[model samples]
Target: MTVSVAHGTARLSAVAGATAGDAYVRAREALTAAGLSEDDIVQVVEYVTDPAAGCGEARPAGVTVSTVAVEGLPEPGATVAVEVTAYRGGGERIATGSGVVTVADEIVYVPGILPADLSAGFREQYRSCLEVAGELLKAAGLGLDALVQTTDYTATATRAEYPHCGRPRRELLGGTGADGRPVHPGAAGILVDRPLTEGAMVSLDAIASRRPLRTVNPGWRRYETLTYKPGIAAGNTLFMSGFGALEPATQRAIFDGDLLAQAEYTYAAIAAVLREARLAGNAVVRLVEYVTPAGIADYDKVAEIRAKYFGGPVALTSVVCSALLRPEFLIEVVPTAVFP
Candidate 1:
């Protein structure tokens, strides 16, 4: 296990083994390395290649934990990646915590699948999950309209099923509502090899707030891309769009067949957008990397770039996927930053 911390965020990467016990032990050592204890942890994001490998049962009762099963991991044989957010001091209890839901002020964190019969098909399961999310938001005095960011982990062979997954989100979250007008949250869909559940087709993870959000698109000309904001800034946090190694002006992929160069270019692009939003690399709190198998082969190069770009600790998760939005694209990076 390798642990790093910066500005209260801790990232733990382990490949020693894939069991839940190994993840727990690594997380414990990471907290100690960050000079933090279990009580300081606010959120935990776990990535596993096999959902059946369950996260160890050694976690504290009230912390927010979100786990997802991905296709592969950056570490050659590693199947689990754990990222944690801990405060400088004893973190305040901003909101009540339940099994997989945590509420704090304007933020809500929910992970894994919503309680629903997996016997249904993908569309039915997705709608049921969103229905549950809507009800939870209403209970918290929020609604689907308050969503700022979302991640859809779907068990599919390709991106063809992406539209089917987005239908529910569009109906539930995109459009005019009682809230006066509607806003679409920044979203990213990753094709997972499998879900935590045996027959489940899709799993949803989200972060919502009561505050309004503003979208940021730097150096935008006109190009065909998915329907999502480049960056959504709400309160002190900036939710960035997934960036690939593409030229800023031409919007064409750069460094074909070169994973390291593409990765460096992608990071540089993300940094440029951060600067446009008046933030810096150190402000980043969380980062998710979607990579193909070839990219994973040279994972060390990516880690070296990450270590050089951010001087402090940042929670990180690297997932191996079948493919990104495009076949030529080897890596896609999603980053979120909290400002001072």
Candidate 2:
């Protein structure tokens, strides 16, 4: 069983020792209690302590389940800690995220459905991923255009295989963004290299969107338009998505070899987003830091940089991975913010 806490319109569910059966039952109960249909539940963010149960079960309709692991949660006896966040309309839901500093807006919008059972075949499954994304956007009164960021996780994926896995989804939304075309906000591929279940291939997630706008000296990036939705009025908001820390001349990270340097690049990149949004240093809300092996070595430096740039209260999450998209790029950042 699980306890829930809801305040200021934020709904949170915490359950321990949850099985797939428990999630199903809870979904039914929650909808009934909330005066909403089962369809109202858009996504489930499950923190699985024991992966043996396989992260509970498939997601119900209009719902997508994202799995994560926490050091401790629910209770001592709890093998699994699960939380279900119900979005009435275009609220934000962070789906399966990984990185050093996780920002508020970095949370991807996931529809209600089991990831493994997303579709019948990878081709159809791939299309389904885009279709689900479209639905989530529609619910928020945004179109595929609102899809500003994307992280695709697949098994043994390569540049050659990206077209096959990612092209269909991109085509459905718009087209590829490789050459300054209207691409799907930010798109990148990750190599999972692990076997997953059915309907599960290329697990993807996204950030909430705001209509884009152009600004003169929006106070940040020189040549970028800034647009994003706030979590709450006078509260924190989404900063930017998929900003890299590469040297303009070499098109590589300014501090490629050192983790602390890579961490520095991430902080600097996030600054650009804040500038574009016309936000100040104080308005910076959250951080999602991504680092390769080299960056992991200097984890303490990464923490130090974070303390320097974002001194105020903030939410953060980080991840150490084998590599990032660029060889010379050791670190990257995605940020979210709110204003007082």
**Clash statistics: count for each candidate:** 2, 32
**Worst window of 10 by summed lDDT in candidate 1:** 174-183
For TM-score, the strongest prediction is 1
Q: Provide the overall lDDT of each model, using Cα atoms, as 2-decimal numbers.
A: 0.68, 0.48
Question: Worst ten-residue run, lDDT, model 2?
Answer: 226-235
Instruction: Please give, for residues 1-340, the per-residue lDDT of candidate 1 as tens digits.
Output: 4454543444454322366566667777778876778877766777777878677575566677778777776555676766666665534343332344555445666545453768887777888777777765665677776777777777546356556756776677743323343346777767667767777777777777656676655756432243456677777677877788877677688788889898888888788878878887887777788888767778767778987776577657677886776567888888887777
Per-residue error for 37 in candidate 2, Å, reads 20
**Residue 256 shift from truth in candidate 2, angstroms:** 2.9
How many angstroms is residue 181 displaced in model 2 relative to the true structure, after the best TM-score fit? 13
Give TM-scores for every candidate, taking all chains together and pairing residue i with residue i.
0.81, 0.59
Tens digits of per-residue lDDT, candidate 2, 13-52, equal 4444446566456645755675555444444555444434
lDDT of 1 at 190: 71
